[model samples]
Target: MIGVGKIKQYSNVLDKPLSKGKQEVSLSAFAFLFSELVQYNQTQVDNIAELERRLEDAGYAVGARVLELLCHRDKGNRRETRLLGILSFVHSTVWKVLFGKVADSLEKGTEHEDEYMISEKELLVNRFISIPKDMGTFNCGAFVAGIVRGVLDGAGFPAVVTAHFVPVEGQHRPRTTILIKFAEEVLRREARLG
Candidate 1:
């Protein structure tokens, strides 16, 4: 069919084997594409929440694919099984691959038993974005949160992920913290297994 041939032509690049050498892209090109994605999603939604949800949904798809490919590339085709193991993978490997560096800090929630946090001084997605004052408490890092949520859910750990901006006085850049809250059943299961 004509459609089938066209689809194959468009997707042929994806069929290529992964090479050992690093695959690099222009950061400016990515920033342009990402900005356009945000602008398009912004025009479709009435509220900040809806716009962020759309962005997150888009990131979720990318994260799902990245999880599979990165697991194969870095873990020798093995998948992480434990909560800590997956957290470490995300904090180190995923951050490195996505941002060209690891996150600033990974911390357990002090009050909550099922909550974890990953803090980045300058989130990659937010580096070029400037939220208008009218947008209220909007943070573009929600897209990254969605990516983390997708990766966890795909790895059999269903959780909610939220991104918050925490500004530090005397600091040049604000911090973005991604909070991950696992379901009660997941925590219970971990306890039972241990």
Candidate 2:
């Protein structure tokens, strides 16, 4: 397998250890790279949702692999089995490892029992993105939502995760919220486990 940063190759994929996704990449640099991804995807699709889906698909795979590697490396192969425990893991552990900070909040949805939201004041992926009028509600945060979905799905919790930008009363920019709605079976399983 070919390694990305150091250009090392391994006979077997497992021969090379998976490193943390964390890097010293600057915000502007990463933004440019992500923009390239968006631009390339834009050329492949005709609509904003399709573009977001393509980006999310990319992120889902990444989130799954990140979950596997990080959990194994940091948590010693054990995984979260409960809903709240897994939510906490994603909100605090995953965010910290990938973005260098914990999410601003992980709140249970007031109207729904199986719904949860992860809010970030300045999600790294969305920091430098400026939405044009044509795109409407398109957000690069969809990729991050894909990541969260991948992590949750990998951990045995199937959820419908989507990214949305919410307006803050006095803030210059809106906050990014990742909404997670777990499947009924998953919620039932959690109840049984509890």
Candidate 3:
């Protein structure tokens, strides 16, 4: 067994409650941190896919914690049981908390009943990022996709979330669309309860 060194305990920090009032974080700070995260991940991977996967993994962990904290603070420690209800909560409440505003649009897939899309004109995480031309099919929104997946999974609605860039003719840049595909079991459960 390895001997453990004396560690300073900060139990009071854990005991403190999260503030219910609107708390804001500096956008510049977030941007710098995200930039560092991308740079660090990029160095560890050879391809765009691997780099994106690393970012998603990091975001997933953050999402899980954020979901729990938000639910506890705002939902009276209750989880949304309905599919549409959860989606609406994420679209409005979660989006506001994360980005200081709601998403541009939320729509269901025309071809698939279990698929949903949340469109954002500009994803906050991708604001200051500039992808190189060599990195084919790279969108920093993949991190947000992982966050969505983590939240849904934590709330018992397991789903796959992917980020896609859909260009709008008049827009300055392509919009980021988060495509969510709920699991079969989740849909079945929703149907049974609904």
Candidate 4:
């Protein structure tokens, strides 16, 4: 069973009933707060890479906690070991827990057995992110990539996660895909264990 205490804490913080399985929130509020956070972190860091790494660290903490909550929510199911299985768990379980919906798609990298992807529409951070011409290298999705990395790491995957914006042909909004690449040792161990 899910941790009743944690769920109750979330409800109390959000100031709403806890029995409901889900709730709606204002995206504007989230966007503004996230922007401010990014800006604040920017001031504390030396360069773009460092700034991104800091944001990812923040997301990593959230990811670790989220993984615990989700596992409890699912009645403590054994953690996934296979590459495909864990990737699916991240796309559906982790995505839903964080964003209130499953990712739009989950795919494997054709060229790499260790690489996986989770794509989503309407990424929360990028919804209002506008990069100025002077700062053409900014991407707010690094936080999300960090979260994915944290989740996978907490689950023993030890992978690198990168977030990219891929525009769908007909979709007005860009699709954000989080590419996860497992370390070589992890893949080798899996093979040996199997």
Model 4 agreement with the true structure over 1-194: per-residue lDDT tens digits: 35866654443554553233545667788888898989999899988788878888888998888777777667354677777777788888788767788888888889989888888786778878876666555567889988889878988989988877787898875688888899998999899988
Question: Which of the predicted structures, 3 or 4, would earn the higher lDDT when compared with the native?
Answer: 3
Ranking by TM-score: 3, 1, 2, 4
Q: The CA-based lDDT of model 2 is what?
A: 0.91
- How high a TM-score does candidate 3 get? 0.88
Residue pairs with backbone atoms closer than 3 Å in model 4 (clashes): none
- When 3 and 4 are scored with TM-score, the better candidate is 3
lDDT tens readout by residue for model 1, 1-194: 23754643446775655554665668888889989999999889999999888988888887798799898888877889899999999999998888889999999999999999999998888888888989988888888998998899888888989899888899966799999999988898899889
Report the lDDT of model 3 for residue 76. Answer: 75
lDDT of each: 0.88, 0.91, 0.88, 0.80
Candidate 3 residue pairs that clash: none
Give residue 22's lDDT in candidate 4 (0 to 100).
48
Question: TM-scores for all candidates?
Answer: 0.88, 0.87, 0.88, 0.81
Ten contiguous residues with the weakest lDDT in model 2: 16-25
| Model 2, span 4-113: residue lDDT tens | 79787689998777665545668787788889998999999988889989999989998999889778988888999899999999999889878988999999999999
Clashing pairs in 2: none
Backbone clashes, candidate 2 = 0
Off by over 4 Å in 3: 1-18
